[model samples]
Target: MENENKIKLFLVDDDALFLKSLEIEFMENADFTIETFATGELCIAQLSNNPDIIILDYQLDGIDQTAMNGIETLDKIKAFNPNIPVVMLSSQDKIEVAVNCMHHKAFDYVVKSETAFMRLQKIISAIFEYRKMKKELNWYMDRM
Candidate 1:
């Protein structure tokens, strides 16, 4: 049974199996509330509703996103909510692409595989820490 109070997650991926599998895995393993889409466009549409985290695939169908790939999507997502944590996911292991995605503000870029679930857990933990730190820093800055 899925817990009613699990952290919300919005996952974006073109592969249906990947999206569905990850959703189930996260739900079963981490007690997370998940909403998944097979395309970036759909995921982007739902992002305005304020999901706690976004797992975005580097590629999407029907969206000529290769030139910018996931970076363009990241820009748009950040524009709407800069503080919302986003983790980029891709089958490719190219460092340049990963670097570019990070430069564009992805919390982390993860390579998809059998260990993807563990990586995601680490990402969630890291993002949680990052947000906590940001809040602390913000509080300090306000006092200063």
Candidate 2:
């Protein structure tokens, strides 16, 4: 939670209000160095910063009709660095949509709702825990 090691979060959403709200929630409830982008292109451009996690909106055409959607952004992120975790966020709670996100290798899919912030928090925690386990496993394997 300390500034030196706070989680760096990238939030990509076309909705300014929602993006700001989500940013505020994370800032207040958790310790995250957050950067928000209104377009997927902007987010992709900043990939060099290496955010710890990316929460991308499913629909990104709100601000720009021609802009790439969340899935496209997710793909680009993966292409740049498949190791970075990307979480898809959308108002759609349909199972098919969730499955599609998983198919594209999203870390997780989160529905935009009152409980979204809490759900995201849990998902982020799980991601780090999994990473820790993987690192430990690799270390043991190296020893072996």
lDDT of 1 by residue, 1-144 (tens): 454567889988877888889988887788677788776667778886678999998876533434334667788899999988899998989999799889989999999999998999998998888788989999999999
Query: Mind giving the per-residue lDDT tens digits that candidate 2 earns over 1-144?
Result: 366698999999999999999999999998899999999999999999989999999999998899999999989999999999999999998999999999999999999999999999999999999999999999999999
Clashing pairs in 1: none
User: Which pairs of residues collide in model 2?
Assistant: none
**Candidate number with greatest TM-score:** 2
Give the residue spans of candidate 1 off by over 4 A: 1-5, 62-69, 140-144
Give candidate 1's root-mean-square deviation (CA, Å). Answer: 3.2
Q: Could you tell me every candidate's TM-score relative to the true structure?
A: 0.85, 0.96
lDDT of 2 at 4: 61
Full-model lDDT, candidate 1? 0.83
Whole-model lDDT per candidate: 0.83, 0.95
